[model samples]
Target: MTTPTIPGFTRHRVRVDDGVALNAAVGGAGSPVVLLHGFPQTHLMWRHVAADLAADHTVICPDLRGYGASDKPAESGAGVYAKRTMARDVVRLAAALGHDRFTLAGHDRGALVAFRAAMDHPDAVSRALFLDVLPTLDMWGALRGVSAAVGFHLYLMAQAPGLPEKMIEAAPEPFFAHFLDAWTRDADAIPADVRAHYLAASAAAVPSIVADYRASAGVDVEHDTVDREAGNKLAMPVTVLQQDWGAALGYHARGLWSAWSDALRHRTVSCGHFMAEEDPRLIAAEIRALADR
Candidate 1:
């Protein structure tokens, strides 16, 4: 299967951990910025925004480990796919590419990783833009009643491992395509070729994908709880763009985010969950605004 990449960007396979290498598209040159793709997608989601940012900033879009062309290590232990681990992969990936620190942007699952990074390695993430997600702790706390059904995939993946992986791998393409079709505002946002690429990549990484989500249910929450208890917070300037899931879920997103970040700008956007793809210009503008501040 032919994979679509950001045009004019060069690709890199940089080793970030033992037997793990992340595939990244790197382009432009100035201050550095790293774009992390969310679940059911690869770095291709950032194609439009990355191209636009490349004019003045060095943009690095990497397929997070276990998602796209990146290596998918076994769950190994509960810690393997933890957001802490994934966040470290991001930091190491940036360091390997000659960036000691960089502005951060992540969508969906990637947003969780960016949140962990900002809290754990404050010195490494100067600013952050999180798209359409709450922190793990806030997410679980908010999913109280019927409205949580929209996140059935999370419950499915958070199961005790074997079952969810078997069920998803049984019909991987359809399973992955369900979100690709359901989570976007514009049908044309993801072109046919790009859609095919996402399905193929996601289908190929079912086990690792399930493990990643499984970690969220286990070790990730523990890590987040520790931070919350310790009163740890994000030191960087942070901007969050999200669909109005908060209203339906019975939580105040701005309040939750404000607790974690000293400087937070939360916007309730009209776009769908895949905002970077559906509204790339707005996403890019928000990233630039936060990064420049």
Candidate 2:
């Protein structure tokens, strides 16, 4: 599938672990920063911010296991796509690239992975930026009324094994295109060509993509709950940029995150769920601030 082009970046595949390989676009030169894309999209989601960050940082934008050109192995079980494993894949990918410790950022489902990475590998992540997502537990707890309606996809994807995969595979384009269109504030931000790439990549990886989301409800929650009970929080500085959905959803987004992070900077951005695409400069600035920490 065609991927977005970042002017100074060159694409490469990194074998993160057995049965998992990440298709990454590597660029620039300096302390490494890995940017993970969320569902229905790939590393291409970071095109604008990656190029800007590439000016000083060794920016690594990788399609999380099941997306883009990355390998989409069969899910052995629910834990297969758990954020814990995905986090390990990311840590390995960074270490293989010679970065033992670095800054990290994720948008959407990617943000979930990045959060797990920070909690599981504190020393390895100097700082983390989470875009448009809450902790998985908090996310589930906050669902009600309109919020639940908007997050219907999460429930749809978190279904029993064959069902979600079978349904999405039947008509992947419209299924994938639904999110690309629904979540973006400016349709122009994601050009028609870019949207096509997202649809194509997602269509080809429906089963694995569904498995990834399914894990969030099962193993991902188990992991998060264990961490929460153990009083485990991200040691690194954490930056959260999200739409002001907390009040509407009957939540204090910052309060929830503050419980998981001592050094937290939370702010609201008036964009749709795809903040990175809607405002790359703003997202880049947040990363730069976190990197400076």
Candidate 3:
């Protein structure tokens, strides 16, 4: 099957592992930059940012594993969609593209996977940018009573057995679109076709998507715990852009982020949850700054 191509961007599928084929879009030429998309969206979320970066850098955005045109496998208990596994997929994808070391940036769910990538393969990633999310351990720890309710999806999808898969598959569009619409401060920023594509990709990958979330509640937490106890913070320069959700929820955002990295530059964007899509120029500028640093 032929993968759909976005104008001004060339699409390619590179096999990262035995069963995993990642659909990636590459453009421009200098220093590679891999952009990972968050949940309920594919690499398509990077369309605008990729276009801008492609003018100066080789912007590679991939549909993570089970999302978008990438290969999808049945949910296997032996090979769950843990962040480590997903991060490895990105690492292999970069090597396959001849990028031994590259800058990494991700938003939302992708940011979580990027975090794992930096943690597991610090040598491969030169710098890191995480948008609109706290580390998995900190996120879970931040929850308290009603304030935690904002992140209901985390707990909901982390259920036992196959309940989340079954429930989400039944009404995937609403489940996926709810966040896309609710989290954005400006709805018109996302075009109709792009929105439909996001819904389609998300709806088709229900089981794997749920597995990714479930891992966060299980294996991902274990990994983060070990890293925290070992005091293994990100060695590379780190920049975090987020809304003041911590302040809104009565927690110190800067203080929490400072605990995670020694060299940290943090900012609060006025935009809502989908910062990359809603404000690609700013996102691209921040990534460029990270690359330069």
| lDDT leader | 1
lDDT of 3 by residue, 70-166 (tens): 8877667634577888899999999998999999999888999999999889999999999998899888888878988888889988997578888
Q: Write candidate 2's Cα lDDT for 1-293 as tens digits.
A: 45558788898889988867888899999878999999888898899999888888999998898888989888887767888989999999999989999999999899999999999999899999999899999999999876689888899999988888888888888888888888888999999778888888889989888888899888899999999999988998889998998777899999999999999999999988888888999999889878976
**Highest-TM-score candidate:** 1
lDDT of each: 0.91, 0.89, 0.87
Tell me how many residue pairs clash in candidate 2: 0
Q: Each candidate's TM vs. the true structure?
A: 0.98, 0.97, 0.96
Q: Which ranges of candidate 1 are over 4 A from the true structure?
A: none
RMSD, one per candidate, in order: 0.9, 1.2, 1.8
Model 3, poorest ten-residue lDDT window?
1-10
Q: Write the per-residue lDDT of candidate 1 for residues 1-293, one digit (tens) a residue.
A: 57787899999999999999999999998899999999899999999999999988999999998999999998889988999999999999999999988999999999999989888888899999899999999899889788999899999999996999899989999899899888887989999999999999999999999999989988999999999999988888889998987768899899989999888888999988888888889998988887777
| Candidate 3 global CA lDDT score | 0.87
Worst 10 residues of 2 by lDDT: 1-10
Query: What is the TM-score (0 to 1) of candidate 2?
Result: 0.97
RMSD of model 1 against the true structure? 0.9
